[model samples]
Target chain A: MIVDEVDKQIILATQAGLPLVAQPYQAIAAQLDLTAEEVMQRMRIMQENGIIRRVGAVPNHYKLGYRYNGMTVWDVVDEQIDYLGQLIGQLDFVSHCYHRPRHLPEWPYNLFAMVHSKTKTGVTEKVNIISQELGEFNRQQEVLYSTRILKKTGLRIGR
Target chain B: MLSDFYMQLLNDYQQDFPLTPRPYLAIAESLGVSEDDVLLAMQELTDQTLINRIGTIIKPNKMGKSMLVAMAVPEAQLQRVAGIVSSFSEVNHNYERENRFNLWFVLMSSTGELLQDTLDEIEQQCGYSTMRLPLVADYFINLGFELDLERDQELDREPDNGCDRLSTN
Candidate 1:
């Protein structure tokens, strides 16, 4: 992708994650020899372009007391995915939601949902609510919980 | 152009740092700032909720085996199911998408078989079917935004790790 100069700097600075300092942005600007406004502006552009999803910290849920979390997949009629997906996305506990092609034999889900909670019981309760609203789900729905947290960081810049 | 300070912070966060006590202090020293300043900035970010949490990144494949699983949970039972699904430590990220397969999450385990077993348990527990999709190929794009910052022309590179299966979980 042909990224602009200002966007490039901002990408480099944030890709690694923000510095641990009082004026981290200021520090980034100083090193880059650019004004604060310039940096912030570039970031805004990248966000608008969808090049950057959001400029924020990637939280470690495990460390933050979110012991129970699961990725749920569903097999719904292709036509109904969008309708149900939006409703599912609105749940506060749900973090990421998207539509992916169903990988047959091995993967049967056409829609995906992610949820985070404090305990297994809580997660089950949330699942029940979703089931009730939709009336019913695919014949097979699976929840995959996290056993270990691997790499969790922003994208590594192209450089 | 952004102030040099923010750039410095970005630079610090870009690499894997030493797993040392007082890691923030070391970062502060490198930036020629007091340790307190580093701590405060971090606190401010967290307070504002701009930062979710700071921690180590685990390499899933190296640790064992894992799979990306999805399921369509009924709308009425979405919340209840999520609460139950999250209870399992194996589920790392959970999202509600606008699709038939409404629930999606990543299941990481020390072995692929173990991951499957965990999914089975979830199906039995939630009374739903799950479709497991191990990553076929991944285009590792480390995307980040500066909100309103300008782009730098100097740092441009190509994507790394193409279908190697070694890079993804």
Candidate 2:
């Protein structure tokens, strides 16, 4: 999105993650040859424009004692999928929910909800809650549990 | 025992992480602790893998194009397929799941149109069918985990499910 020199620098610096320090912006400012205030101001603008989503900790669910996690997909009516998605997203257990295109007869689920819990029972109960939530519109659904994590890492932005 | 300050760092800052230059100092002031302590705990949390990282989650479709891709690799070819998929820098995350379409990976590209060609090449290279599930709309997307310290002392508390749309705040 028209990333200027400063914006580009900021993304690269924090892409890995803002360092765990007291003055992270100051640290970035020192590297970019700008004052801490300017760096903070620019990032505020970026956040306002939706460029920087949120500045916070991204925890590894696998390390958090959340042993059981499943991605539940639903084939809901296309017309009402958005409305249904919002309702599903609000559920406490549904960490990440999205409306994605389905491939066809082979892949029919359009709504994806990432459900996480400490145990299988927790996941099952949450799935039941979601099913009840989408009772009428739920056509077909499936939960794909991860058998192995081949790779897990954050998105790398500019450089 | 999970320190009160640590729990506060997770619960309070998950959402409006301070936009100031000295956020840890700000947090320290509020939590009645030293700035170094706040920084140390946050660093410790990250070092121990409790938190993946402390960073900005860029909004989707803002910088580049990404698609959720799945491949049905016969058990025999799963490893080979994974190696091929992982070799591509565009793939940020890949996983093996319990399903006929077992190998799932997210492929990202700087240019949006390149997505198809890359997927096509991967399919041709691996001789497997790859399904593309591009994101359409995000409802609630929060990637942060609150650690939920209260649950230990208070069993009656309901699980707090606070999710923002994945990439967007």
Model 1 has a DockQ score of 0.05
TM-score of chain B of 2: 0.82
**Candidate 1 lDDT score at position B124:** 94
Off by over 4 Å in 1: A136-139, A149-154, A157-159, B1-169
* Docking level of model 1: incorrect
Question: How close is each model in CA RMSD to the real structure?
Answer: 15.5, 4.8
The worst-scoring run of ten residues by lDDT in candidate 2 chain B lies at: B160-169
Q: Mind giving the per-residue lDDT tens digits that candidate 2 earns over B47-166?
A: 666566777777776677888899888898899989998877778788888999998888777777787788888888888888888889988545454454543442222332321112
| Reference-based TM-score of each model | 0.49, 0.89
